[model samples]
Target chain A: MTRLEIDHLYVPVAGRTILHDIGFTAEGGSLIGLVGPNGAGKSTLAKTIAGLLQPASGTIAVNGVALDTMDRRDAARKIAYLSQGDTVHWPLAVRATVTLGRAPHSGRFGTASPGDRRAVEAALHRADVLSLADRNIQQLSGGERARVLLARALAVEAPILIADEPVGALDPRHALNIIGLLREEAARGALVIAVLHDLALASRFCDRLLVMRDGRLAADGPPHDVLSPAGMEQHYAVAAHHGTHEAERFVIPWRTLNAADRKPNQEGETA
Target chain B: MNRLPAPATSRIGTAPLCLILLGILAGLMLASLTIGYVHIPPGRLVQAAFGMADPATTTIVQQLRMPRMILAALVGASLGGAGAVLQGLLHNPLAEPGTLGITGAASLGAVVALYFGLAATVPMSLPLCAMSGAAIATVILLVVARDSASTLTLILVGTGIGGIAIALTSLAMNLSPNPWAVSEIAMWLLGSVKDRTFSEVWLALPFVIVGLAALLAAAPSLDLLSLGEDTARSMGLNASRLRTMAIAGTSLAVGAGVAVSGSVGFVGLMMPHLVRPLVGQVPSRTVLPSIIGGGALVLASDIVVRLIAIGPELQLGVLTSLLGTPFFLYLVLHLRRQLP
Candidate 1:
């Protein structure tokens, strides 16, 4: 189990602040959906947490250990990251791609151990890619390729898994399948964080939603609380029809809202 | 890469295939020693090789043929292995060893050494100067080109460096003291393995060995780099360290190669691509076979040059270009649909 804490993180790229004073704590065994509008710094925060970017200020700690103090290989063993769609540069075999996740666990010159092979096998099985293991990554469908990358990350068996838009181009069914896989990872005691664009999927699957707007954490709470019409209007500038049926709450964005017309008969409540 | 059975299984267990290539390399090396203007019989060749034959045969085999053959093989191996490293490091199929200006820099150093009569005055000065030039080129390349730029940007920067170095070399030749030195520079620029000595072989072997070792050690990193830079870093690969090893290895290997042989072209660039079908596209798997294939290509080209030339021997570099350009174009045309 891992505790991932990003405290007062500020990230700058090219002299412009991209993530400002953003903070989040993700305990093990929960699926976190990071949501945001376009250019809202979600990917920047994901990359920073994955150690692909260095923050300008504040710290990221994994299980009470400062990320800055840990050796890169050690950190890799603790946190596995999968970038967005088509991150694979080589046309590697699915099995070969997944096996690369064992890099940090292998011996000198990446001589694999039995444990590593077992991990790859388990990852393939868990990601439902065992049958595609022998296929070329480039030849696979987009959704299948995404699953292979997921298996690659799963092969790491890290306590924390961070994926930046893993399902961005996936169809709805594939997206739901992927979200369910992340939920499974969380159930298995991994701190799973995925940046998602589909609000309905996020509300349906994620245990918590961390919403970002213009470099700030606009909302952080259960989906029901974060997807309220007022919360959505303030951050997203959209009006949505929200309803609860039995045990489920769903948000359907109906129209764009202007600032002046946003308040309703609550014009009287303002007094 | 070895943990699972790769989908590209033709090269899965490649020991036997590499052994066959090594065997072919050995055969070609022997043929290079035996087949020339004066053909030595197999029995006499063995005697000449072991220094038991008459003085003339012994001199022809031990002194003349031996150094040239060894140097050709070494040069070929260095270039091929270096090309493989470069392609892996940059994730570009067009990434040749000379694409980063190491060979051009080496050529500049050698030309300067020749113009100053340093090569004639000091036996070690030529290789030393060439290696220094290569090192400088690598330093400049790293400082300028290895900064997360797009692949095309890196290639363009390298081409600019090569252009400047080449222009300077031509300028130096234009100002030569006499026509003889000018012609000599011109012929040397065409690249050959003629009249090389055992001492030059000894001078270059260490750098090639060191470069090969460094690249082999960094094989795992190259594999991860093939996964793309972001995932490679998240996998705990040190990008700076990977780039350093790659650049250092290419510098030593190609610099030493250019030092011994003037500037043999295309063998390094062509061998890896040719051997990929046999070994799959994995960079690590391509190293040994490409090295062996490179040595064979050099020996075969040298043989053809010797067999066809009636007066002056054809330049090894010229033969390679004639042989390689069409093959390279064919490969690109064939792989046009598949290339990234």
Candidate 2:
């Protein structure tokens, strides 16, 4: 099975520590959700894993190979990263854009092999963007653009997928559809780590959750256990409404807990 | 709802487009050879190529026009390829060697060479000095914007350098001792490929070849970069390495061209945009066509300069600017909507 290990990763942005002592181990066949409030270092941690940002200290590895030491092409072959709010600078065709996902395997001049074309075709079909293949990316609707970009990442066919806010700004139906795709990717034996803002989707669909608070991994466990009432109140400083629907558990943030609402012992607990 | 608009595909395929561009370049190059003041017919030109023509015809074709024509092709290819690479790297359609100050710095270097009377006395000093100026500007821009993490910083620094170079050139013009010196400087700034010899051709050829090769190698990486830096890096692109290669290549190719010919503008800026409709918007794919298209445009412009023969010859750079400015203004006016 494909495995990702981030050990005591300390990432700094502009010389200020953003992700401190963050560590996690993720394996294939599970959907892991990374959820946190604004500036909680979740995206920072994700970027570090994607190799966009180097860690200030500590290591990130896949299987037994150190990510820092591995050939970038080899690393790219193993880990596919989908950035938040991705924009295409040029008005490229959707098929051509998705075909860029095969950059690592296509070599220097990008002559697509038969196997590469098959992978791109499969990714286009999987993300439901096959019909829009000939359309320009600049003409795509926001939801359609999101799926096309997802198709680009899926074309990598990597063993691990790291997506930051994959469903950001999407409507409910599209968001649920994207989340379902991630779950399906996990079922197909790819390790999928997605940063999500929606607690309901995170708790209901993820096999595990990694909660971030003040640049630390505050909690890590199955979503149900990690989103306990006390855990939610402690890390998120909010009262969560919990319920079971169709035999699936869900947690929705019902109200913000201000300094005045915190118990004496919990007062000044936020860093 | 009405059906969404689709992207326009090339009615002509890439291979066909490239072949057409090549044919145009060949036809233009041939026209460049024969259409000078002393017109040699195509049959005589063929004999001249093999040294079988009369000495006068052979001397005119082999000695004079050949170097000038080669220079035009080299300068044009440099500007065109450099422009496409800069546009792709900066993710801005407007980026070019002229905009990034490399061409301006090269102009300043040539001016300095002329100011000191170094160009008249020394055989290769003019181009060498101009190339040095371009190299220095490139190094300063790269070093100050070391990260390549922020393209904005690189562009801002480049603009500042370009402004400084133009100011220095103006200062040189203002302080000239005589009207003759001033006119000489002004004429050089207007840019031309007249009366150049094989020496100039030999000087620029290597740098242009190396520089264009570097840019062509960068095409695939540039394609990946159009998706944004973060995504490009995630796909194993060594972005800093790519940036260094691109800027250095621009300096060498464009710097050497500026050294040999003066500042030929708009060819670099316009060719890639013109080639885009035929090649689609992929940055890498736009490169080769831009190179060939650039060569064709310059050769055609040079031929026009020769054919005009009005009073004195029209400036090559002046003709390009006359053509390029309208296209540039159109781009600015329609900046809101992304065009193919």
lDDT of each: 0.82, 0.86
- Tens digits of lDDT, candidate 2, B2-86: 1125443643566788899999999999999999888889999999978899999998888889998999999999999998988
Model 2 lDDT per residue over A97-156, tens place: 999999978868658999999999999999999999998887888888999999999999
Error of 1 at A176 (Å): 1.8
Error of 1 at A130 (Å): 1.2
Best by lDDT: 2
Q: How well does chain B match by TM-score in each candidate?
A: 0.91, 0.90
lDDT of 2: 0.86
lDDT tens digits by residue: candidate 1, A82-179: 88867554556788889889988886565678899999999999999999887767778889988999999999889999999988999988888888
The C-alpha TM-scores of every prediction are 0.92, 0.94
